[model samples]
Target: MLATAQALIGRKVDIVTSSKILAIRDASNDPNEG
Candidate 1:
């Protein structure tokens, strides 16, 4: 199931991974939360 989804959305995973990394970087810059 998971593998099928991964195969179906390989390009999406790349985008999602970049977005998640950006979110984490932005989160790190914020002082309100850890």
Candidate 2:
């Protein structure tokens, strides 16, 4: 299920922009809750 979603997203994103989108998403969802 997860792999399918990943494949869909990969197909939708342009290669150059995907990394930046992922970086922003990761930053916004920071796990260290302190």
Candidate 3:
């Protein structure tokens, strides 16, 4: 999902480190938090 978001936005995300995001880790299972 992170790759998809990056593709759509054409750039990497700049979210905070402690942000509770789906793509925060590589073992994420959610597909809607990128």
Best by TM-score: 1
Give stretches of model 3 more than 4 Å off. 12-34
TM-score for each prediction? 0.37, 0.34, 0.28
Q: How much does candidate 1 score in TM-score? A: 0.37
Could you report the Cα RMSD, in angstroms, for every candidate shown?
A: 8.6, 8.5, 8.2
Sorting all predicted structures by TM-score, with the top scorer first, yields 1, 2, 3
**Displacement of the residue 26 alpha carbon in candidate 1, Å:** 0.1
The 10 consecutive residues of candidate 1 with the worst lDDT sum are: 9-18
- In candidate 2, clashing pairs total 0
Of the two candidates 2 and 3, the one with more favorable lDDT, higher being better, is 3
How many angstroms is residue 3 displaced in model 3 relative to the true structure, after the best TM-score fit?
A: 0.2
lDDT of 2 at 9: 75
lDDT of 3 by residue, 1-34 (tens): 7867886877866554555564456337665655
- Residue 11's lDDT in candidate 3: 86
User: Compared with the true structure, what per-residue lDDT tens digits does model 1 show for residues 1-34?
Assistant: 6656887876333233457778888779976954
Q: Number of the top candidate by lDDT?
A: 1
